[model samples]
Target: MIPFHFTGARVLRPGGLIETPVGITEGRIVDAPCGRAVDASGFLLLPGIVDPHGDGFERHLAPRRGAMLDMGDGLAMLAVELAANGITTAMLAQFWSWEGGMRGPDFARAMLEAHAAVAPLQAVDLRVQLRVESHLLDDFDAIAACVERFGVGYVVFNDHLPHRQLSEGRKPPRLTGQALKSGRSPEAHLALMQALHQRSAEVGPAVAALVARLPGVRFGSHDDDSAERRAFWRALGAGISEFPETLEAAQAAVAAGEPVIMGAPNVVRGASHAGKVSAQALIGQGLCAALASDYHYPAPRQGALKLAETMGLEAAWALVSDGPARVLGMTDRGRIEAGLRADLLLLDPETGRVGATVAGGRLAYLGPEMASRFFG
Candidate 1:
């Protein structure tokens, strides 16, 4: 990678945007100029986005429901999208659920192995977040083995089963669709849900025990709906709250000093598609600590820009960059400061599009508008 002396852009710093020349050499930001001189008078130099949670890579991994045989190509394509969207560091959320096909335990293990193999070759720093289904007690040992073997540091507990319908012996909505997706018959899927629901008493203790086993792993709760649910996960040593479904849960997590992660799409869409608490509302109340891309890679950048309309660019941008880096306990690349990793983006102020992206002091992406500036 060629070292760079970036001049003429309004650089975003911890204080605010400033007309300062930034330098990058050997993958770290520096004070003095290095190798090449680049004129960037028309762009906004910002830190490369650090996305905490996103599953948009799933489509690239299996675009047509098992159409992809090799994971490397899909991951390579995913990296291009990440860089194009100005994402430098991303946590790819993979599922260890009862759902078969792409989301099964087998698929999770394969994905983890493939990610480990492909990460070294990509410029974007890609990490995996294993989403464990709480009711899958039989797979606890396998999950632990995978975590240990793969060095997975982040884990989130999820319970997507419709316990209410299953407990009442009623058919859950979308039962047929889900069953077909999982390659299971509707009757078998319903029976499995019922079995898992019947063992509800065992799940809490089992999850707590699993959490205890993974001492070094960062734990979080997914889709927390109430204060009690948040408290339950917190009591189990989960420190992060991912997408609290209601205001009460968000407030409870904030009051408990846990970082609350909201979907960036919620802020962009102005509301939750699932009829849950609005992310913008939570951000206004100071309850949200970070905004995750969730299922959409473009939402993080778009969401922050939207919030910048009122919260100021610095604060809104922090929700996607510094805030998420803090949530992940990564102190290396979120801020554009000396001695930190040189992960950055050059955005066109007029159109709000990324003109170029630099990750680890290497040019990861270059848009058409900025191509001539770098080459000509």
Candidate 2:
């Protein structure tokens, strides 16, 4: 069946706009200005978004303070929201750790099984990208097993603790309401962090060794704070920098030919909530390569529109969609093209509210309930 054909929308394709029609078939773009039309006048059509970072594991596997929801529920809700925002592909950041609670081995297992059951049914492209915390090295074997089961696509080395330690404990600190609710004093928390820091150091070598063999999986580094840090990660075979915390780190990644991602929230908020480097600053310097929604699901789309409004249309749109897709090796979906993936987002050009989102040429998200009505 002809999947879909949207007309009258400003088509974002290679080299620019297409005042023509789009032919979507078999979940990929079959041709351009090639067929029938689905009314989309006054809308700006764009490629489906690509999001590489977001710790949804925490939200789904561990929803509240000491409360863990069904793995399926979290994934379900996330799928809707993601598709709504034109995110045709989402990399679920699976946090694996030997630590108690959220990132525990048991939780990881549940996640792996859950993904196995649902990823295939997703409306948008869904893949698992293990977010490995070196401190969680004790669970490395189990993690490897899970990756094999999930056909994992990517892995990101996250040493938040180590970076904080080097920066004198200044990074976005973690907070488990359970811990605070348990009446764990601030001193106790500090002690826990220090212990976690030590644990991270203890298993670094083993994690390094395991990561070396997963060549099929692309590797990334998280929260890079400096040029040296970027170089160090690149040396470790992690060529993508996820949310580099400083402009210098982003520049270093660019210099090394590594794609650097920034949080979409950073772009919308104009800076990091954690007081780190601003996404705007990085974008202005041409140091940004990708955009991830981070904690908020709706941020990516809104951030893209905001970035476009501020940084000119072409550049802003690239940060969230084409740019990230390019870095992730998704040559098929970033922009509208013949023989590419038919992932498109139709937006009300004025407010940028997503009017319709089609994945694989199927309209997956639309109108009121289809999108986060708050922004877009």
In model 1, which residue pairs have backbone atoms overlapping below 3 Å?
none
Reference-based lDDT, residue 253, model 2:
88
**TM-scores, one per candidate:** 0.98, 0.86
Off by over 4 Å in 1: none
Candidate 1 lDDT by residue in tens digits, 156-191: 999999988877778999999999998899999888
How do the residues 1-376 of candidate 2 rate in per-residue lDDT, one tens digit apiece?
4555667778776666667777787777866544445677778878888888877546665667656456777777778878877788888887775334555556667887887888777777777788887665656777777777678878887764544653475533554553464356545655655766666445546756777756687888888889998887776678899898887888888987788899999888988999999988888888888889888868888898888767766677887788888888878778777888788888777777778788877767888633443134
Model 2 misses residue 145 by how many Å?
1.8
Q: Against the correct fold, how does model 2 do in TM-score?
A: 0.86
Score candidate 1 by lDDT. Answer: 0.92
Once all C-alphas are superposed, what RMSD does model 2 give against the true structure?
4.5
- Number of the predicted model whose TM-score against the real structure is largest: 1
What local distance difference test score does each model get?
0.92, 0.75
